[model samples]
Target: MLKKNNSTPLYNQLVDVLIEHIKTNLDIDEKMLSEREICLKYDVSRTTVRAALNELEEMGYIFKRHGKGTFVSGLWKEMQNLSEAYSFTEQMKQLGKIPHSQVLSLEYIVANQDLAKNVGIQEGEHVYKMKRLRSADGMPMMYETTFIPAYLFPDLTISKLESMPLYELYPQVYNQDIKYADEEFYASVLQAKESEELGLPAGSACLRIRRTTYSQENKIIEYTLSVARGDQFVYKIRHSKK
Candidate 1:
């Protein structure tokens, strides 16, 4: 039973209690308890229970599908921070899995207004577009496309990407410094083409992330579109009030 504690917020206390239950593998298949059930079992108000649930959802410990109740994120989901910039290779390496990238498309295209604006190039400028399927331990994980100003990397080729991660290529071949990036993310359904390429279920829910990376001079050097498997990735962001 939840006895109100002045030292910790009531909602936080409830969250801790629920986390304990989850860690001990209790009632997981019964993935979620209803609001009323939480209130009755924990002797907490609906507001308190909701707060706890929201916290858990934000932390990626659980996810609530629309029209479906919340469920614990399975072990297959990779925990990641939304605010950080990481290559697919680096992420897989951190998880102790072998990373491989298969080139899907590599070409140069005249930048349109939208593409130019995102990568800080003029319209009609040339950009190199590279698309690849990223795999972890031989399992497909993400499909990604990156657009880079051709002028900034004049000598790049598909062969270079085949052998190393983008970050490795940046400093060695392009002589450019790789810096942080701004990213935005949202939930989306996989298109037929994407589903086939990634071996995901047709119309499966996925995470769509877009990013623009900058150099030390604040020049936008690359723009990337990444689609990650919903069942295999979970993103987290921390919040602190100033």
Candidate 2:
């Protein structure tokens, strides 16, 4: 039973009680109690239970599948070093797992005005657009789309990408050295279309990352958008007092 004697608020106290139970006796493979059940057991309102659940979810202690209830997700702590600039293949390689990209769609496309502006290419310029579902140990990890300036690398093909990392192939195929890159990251709920491609529940939380790679001459050579599983990946930034 959760004690009502804490400096913290009731909902926070309830959240701690729930976490304690999970750490003590809850089997990781078993589904957690539903909000209604939790409320009834703890003598709290549904609103309070929802509040506690939201906090636990944000802390990555639990995850909910649409219509499937919540479950413990302790695996997130192991994948905390996701802020580094490593390709899916390279990251998994460091973790001693083979990485593979299942090519979803690849084609030569005329750069639309929106894509052209973002990638620093000419509008209507030819571009090689590719989409792939990245998997590690046969489990889907990310859905990514890439746009490369075809004028710079006309030989782009899905076959080549499937066998090699983009960073490794950039110098060889296009002779374009990657000097630096800029990336932005954010959290978002999966849209219907994204959920379909990534095999996640619609409205599921996910991480959206956009990155642009540059050459030594300061030319933007590649732009990529990636959606990763929220429960399986975390972006960490280490800081030291200056």
Candidate 3:
């Protein structure tokens, strides 16, 4: 039951309640309750029910079929546009999801030949290797390992990492701003350990992304390799007419 005196608006509260039901109780393309039925069941007015349903439709949780009715759509799969630079935390926030990160490991290591080549640094240079699991609304979404040159971020620490997103930290804590990034994506099956971290069965289909982030000075700042759950995301690219 929704609290009459609660701070949240009735429509927003209704949206939350309906989303839970859709995610847990309904299947894809399943018909949802009519606005009148929702109003009766939730003890809310038609205005409140309509407001909530409009928000759900705009968010891609459900779709209306005119005279037919509303039906469940995607299971809240995240949509990502590859044409723009994005941060995982920022993207989740835009989608009304709570973003979380688990620092599985953080240590300093010497860059190997391939790693050095990827980051454009000397093979023996020291780098901070960070392994993290990224989640949205307590659901595991991706497992990633990142390498940042130690000399550029010598003061990086676990406490600082836990405080905010790495992209935010770069400028706030280190006075370093990202200029741009180059990325490559590949289709692959999840490894046993990676699947364990993402809460998926081993050999599950996954998307692997390699990113090289650069500073304004055209120097490589970070290199990250990420394994993401295939069902949880949709990546899009917009091409322009040349």
Give the alpha-carbon lDDT of every model: 0.82, 0.83, 0.87
Provide the RMSD of all predictions against the true structure, rounded to 1 decimal: 11.4, 16.0, 11.3
Pick the lDDT winner: 3
lDDT tens digits, residue span 1-242, model 1: 66575788989989888887776774434567777898999888899899998898766677666676778864213445343546777767767899999988999899999998989989999999999898999999999999999998996788887877888888777777876878899999999999998998889999999988888777887899999999888766656353
Model 1 Cα shift for residue 231 (angstroms): 0.8
Candidate 3 wrongly placed segments (more than 4 Å): 1-85
- How accurate locally is residue 221 in candidate 3, as Cα lDDT from 0 to 100? 86
* Stretches of model 2 off by over 4 angstroms after superposition: 1-84, 240-242
Per-residue accuracy of model 3 over 158-224 as CA lDDT, tens digit each: 8889998999888888888999988899899998888788889999999999989999888888999
For candidate 1, the lDDT comes to: 0.82
What is the C-alpha local distance difference test score of candidate 3? 0.87
TM-score of 2: 0.63
What value does the lDDT take at residue 100 in candidate 2? 81
Model 3: which residue pairs collide? Answer: none
